[model samples]
Target: MLPWLLCALLGVLVLALLGKVCALTRSMEEICDQLADRLAGDTNNLLTLSTRDPHARRLAARLNVQLRLLRQQRRRYLNGDRELKEAVTNLSHDLRTPLTALCGYLDLLDRQETSPAVARYLDQIRSRAEAMKALTEEIFRYSLLAARESWDWEDVTLNQVLEESLLAHYGALTQRGITPQLDLTEVPVHRRLDRKAVSRVLANLLSNALKYSAGDLRVALTPAGEITFSNTAPGLTPVMVGRLFDRFYTVETGRTATGLGLAIAKLLTEAMGGTIQADYRGETLTLTLRFPPAEEKAAPRAVPGGGGVE
Candidate 1:
C-alpha cells in the first residue's frame, strides 16, 4: 500500500510539470504573434503573457524591455528626420534670392555686346549660374515633398503625358544627335495621378538620357502601364546604377548633373502608388516605371529601396 501511494504522488508531480510546460508554450506563441504584428507596422500592443511559470514570466519581461527600446529609437528617428527637412527647407529658401540675382546679372550681361573672348567667359558664367538656379529650385521642391505637400490628383492619361514630355525634349534630343526610339501603346493607359508630377518624372528621365546617352535612347510604354527608358551609358557600373536615385549622388560620367532629378521622380512616383527600378548590363542602363491602374491606385504603395538613372 505504501509503494502504491508513492507512485501515485510521483505521477501527480509529473502531470503538473507537463501542464506548466503546455501553458508556457501557449503564452510564448501569443507573444510571438504580437511581436510579428508590431514589427510589420500593424499593431502597437505590448507583450503580455498570463503564464504563472517563472521562466515564462522572465522571458516576457526581457522581450517587453527590448520592445520599449525599439519604440524609443523609432521616436528619435522621426524627430531627427523632421528637423532635417525643416533645415533643408529654410536653407533652400535663403539661397534662392541670391541665385535669382546672379541669374539676372548673367541675363543682363548676355543682352550686351562684347568681344568673343569676353562672350565666351560670359557664356561659361551663364551656364554655371543657370545650373545653380536649377539645383536650388530642385532642392526647394524636394523639401516641399519631404514636408508632405498636398497633391492635386486627377484621372491622367499617361500616354498623352509621355508623348507631350517627349515632344518638349525634342530639341534637346536633336542637339545630342540621338534619335529616340519610342514604342508607345495605341490604347491610352490611364491612372489616377498628378499630371504635373507624372510629367516631371518623364522629363527627368529624358533629361537624364540626354545627359548620359552614348548615342541612342529607347523608350517604350505598354498598355499595362509599364514605362521603360534605356540608353547606352559608357562608364556606368552596376554599383553606380544601384545608387543612381540616392540624393546628391553623382557619377564621374555626369559632370554637370545635380543628381536630384531621379530622386524627385522616385518620390513622386511612390507617392502616387507606383513602382520604379533600374538595371544595368554590358554598358546599357535601363529604368522601368509602373503605375497602378485607377481601380487599384487606392492600395498602399510600398517604398522601394534605391534605384534609378544618372
Candidate 2:
C-alpha cells in the first residue's frame, strides 16, 4: 500500500513538472515573436508572456530593458542619417548655381580666346570645373536616393537592361581604347526590380571599370541571372576590392570620383532584394550583381507597384 501510494504521488509531481515545462516553452516562443517584431518594425510593444513562471518573467524584464535601449539608439541613428542627407542635398543645390555661372564664363572666355597659353589654361579650368560638377551631381543623386523610402518595382527583362546599359557606355569604353568582351546568355532572366535602380547600378559598375580597367573589359550574363563586369585592373588589390562598395572610398589616383557609384549600387541592390559583390584575383577585378527572380518570391517595392532605379 505504501509503495502504491508513493507511485501515485510521483505521477502527480511528474504531471505538474511537464505542465510547467510546456508553459515555459510557450513563453519563450512568445518572447521570440515579439523580439522579431520589434526588430523589424518601429514598435514600442514589450514582450507579453501568458505563463506565470518566475524565470520567464525575469527574462522578459531583462529583454524589455534591452528593447527600450535599442529603440533609443535606432531613433538617434535615423535622425542623424536624415540630417546628413539633407545637408548633402542642400550643399549640392548651392554648388550648382555657382557651377553653372562658372561654366558660362569659361565658355564665353573660350570664344574670345587670347594667347595659346591662355587657351590652354582655359581648357584646363573648364575640364576641372566639369569634373567637379559631375561629382556634385552624383553626390546629389546619391543623397536623394539614400533617403528614398520607396521604389518602382515591376517585371524587368534583365537581358534588355544589360544590353541598354552596355550600349550607353559604348562611347566611353571605345574612347578609352577598350572594346568590352560580351558573353550574355540568350535566356531571358526576368526579375521584379526597379529598372532605374538597376540601370544606375550598371552605369556605376561600367564607370568604375572605365576608371580602373587596364584597357580590357569583359562582361557576361549567366542564365541564372548573374551579371559580371570583369576588367584587367592591374592596380587593384584584393584588399581594395573588399572596400569597393563602401561610400566615399577611393583609390589614390581616382580622387576625381566621389566613390559613391558602387556604394549607391549596393544601396539600391539591397533595397530591391538583390546583391552586389566585387572580387579581385591576378590583377582582374570582377563585379557581380544579382537580383531574385520575380517568379521565385514576391518582394516589397517602393510603391505597391512600379518600376526603375537611379
Best by lDDT: 2
* Candidate 2, 244-304: lDDT as tens digits: 8888899865868888889888887777877789988888889998876766544654421
lDDT score for candidate 1 against the true structure: 0.84
Q: Model 1 clash tally? A: 0
**Best model per TM-score:** 2
Residue-level lDDT tens digits of model 1 in 1-310: 9999999999999999999878988988978887887776734577877777778778878888888889889878778877877898799899999989988888888889899999999889888887887788888877776675456678898899999999999999999999999999999998887788789899999998988899899999999999999999978999999999999788997867888889988887887889888999989999999997867666534323221212
| Count of clashing residue pairs in every prediction | 0, 11
TM-score of each: 0.80, 0.89
* C-alpha RMSD values across all candidates: 4.4, 3.0
Per-residue error at 6 for model 2, in Å?
2.2
Candidate 1 — which pairs collide? none
Please state the error at residue 102 of candidate 2 in Å: 2.7
